[model samples]
Target: MSQEATFKSIVCEIFGIQEGDVADTKTPEDIESWTSVTHMQLVARFEESFKFQFDVEEITEMDSIASMKNVLRKHGVDL
Candidate 1:
């Protein structure tokens, strides 16, 4: 799989969403599996999966798949 696919897979699995349903338009409001603890868990998972750290602000601000992609880009995740 490509990096984008890897990222999307990680996010989708962490949030308990199907890969087919995990689009850029997806948001926390659209996923019942999303919650504060879920976000923190996701942050940790992303850090481990990407082998880089992210600021809490960035973590807290990721309310959508698109936002997560932006954060990943900002951290030089190679899209």
Candidate 2:
């Protein structure tokens, strides 16, 4: 799958949401499963899947799916 699809799948699985529910606009404030602990878990999962670690700024700015994609891309993840 493409990086975008992989990202979406991972987010959906981590958030316990459906594929159709995953969107760029989705944020922690908008999703019930996106708690602090779960957010960290998601971050870890993303790092594992993409084989890269997010720095403090990247992690803090990843408040939404779109933001996460941007950060990943900035780190050389093709998406």
Candidate 3:
């Protein structure tokens, strides 16, 4: 799968969202499964999947799927 698809799939799984519901606009507020703990878990998952370390600024800015995607891109994650 492409990096975009992989990212979407991982987010959907972590948030307990359906594939059809995955979208750039989706935010933590949109999912019942998304909370502080789950947010950290998702960050760790993204770090592992992308093989890159995120700075505090990046982590704090990860409020939505689109932002995360941009961060991954900025890190040159072979997308």
Q: State which candidate has the highest lDDT.
A: 2
What C-alpha lDDT values do all the predictions have?
0.84, 0.89, 0.84
lDDT per residue (tens digit) for residues 5-79 in model 3: 788778887888898887778887887788998889889998898788999999999888788778888999654
Q: Could you estimate the TM-score for every candidate?
A: 0.87, 0.91, 0.88
TM-score of 2: 0.91
Candidate 1 versus the native: TM-score? 0.87
Tens-place lDDT per residue, model 1, 3-62, is: 787887887787888888887888878888888888888889889988899987988778
Off by over 4 Å in 2: none
RMSD of 2: 1.1
What tens-digit string does per-residue lDDT give for candidate 2 at 9-63? 8888889999888888988888999999999998999899889889998899999
Which model is ahead, 1 or 2, in terms of lDDT? 2
All models, RMSD in angstroms: 1.3, 1.1, 1.4
